[model samples]
Target: MIVSHPRRTIISRHEQFHLAQQALRRLDRGTGLIALGASLIVGAIAALIWLQPHLAPVPASIAINLMTIGIGAACLIAGWRRYSFHRQLRAATAITDAPMIDCWIENAFEGEPGVIAWELVTSQPDGTEVRLRQAQLIDPSLVTVFQRAATVPVRYVPANPTVSALIIE
Candidate 1:
């Protein structure tokens, strides 16, 4: 079996540090969505109740409030799972200085427009298997990179492959 190297993306400690910072920012951004979503939902509900009792009912105004509510629900659902994933990302940071190994992109799913979930797998010399599944928020420009790559760089603790991270852009 032939295993590829991870020099293409992460080769130096300085570069890895920068990548780690970006990853944290991306992971942390989920909170913004959650806040926006909750605000919209609450505002919509309040408007619907308060305005209905004060002003004459207009079909257009009612529709606008409903739309806001719908959009808010979408945002909330999208960020709900993301908040938990952010914690997992923090835990995965332990692999920062660990060696990188090329792992097969066993599966890829674009659950949303700019978010991609990847399943990575590799074999160890001890006949053990390492499997990791991560869902990440990605930039539109790098969407093609993730979609086209057959293998990506992964860092895992030597003693425990379960604590691994797929260096994402």
Candidate 2:
């Protein structure tokens, strides 16, 4: 007797991978720009006050500078949080023969300690669609990344697709 096993699906990630990489780069770049801009604005004002002969305007007061620095520090903290969160998501303890698929977040909700519920979507080569349900314990530190990113690359074993991990970290 002859038997045929289902051919494993072949998914090309050339464009998908680049697109995801570009998206992530854009996110980090934006975060950096925000922090940098905030710092530059305050720095420019302070330099003008110090370099000029006349007294600067009230807007350049010490209180204003402190407030501006506070805002910039907050942005830096949030950016750090996002970077760490992505790192954790992509960190894997072991390797497997799981296939990576591009997926989008269908929806998300939060509860105590921020348990996030999201449905991951994928399109198969056979014109079939797959949506896998997933949930993770989300902490406040990681919420920044989740709130900013919606596309999550996922890897799963063909035998047991129910258990999966995020292709992030």
Instruction: Please report the candidate that would top TM-score against the real structure.
Output: 1
The residue pairs found clashing in candidate 2 are: 86-169, 87-169, 90-168, 90-169
Per-residue lDDT over 19-89 for candidate 2, one digit per residue giving the tens place of the 0 to 100 score? 33433432342457456756756785675568444545565565666666667667666666656544544
Candidate 1 achieves a global lDDT of: 0.55
Clashes of 1: 0
For residues 25-99, could you state the per-residue lDDT of candidate 1 as single tens digits? 454547888999999999989999999767677888789999999999999887876675555545653333322
Badly placed stretches (over 4 Å) of model 2 are 1-53, 56-60, 94-169
Candidate 1: which stretches are off by over 4 Å?
1-28, 92-119, 122-169
TM-score of 1: 0.46
Q: Each model's TM-score?
A: 0.46, 0.34
Cα deviation at 75, candidate 1, in Å, is 0.9
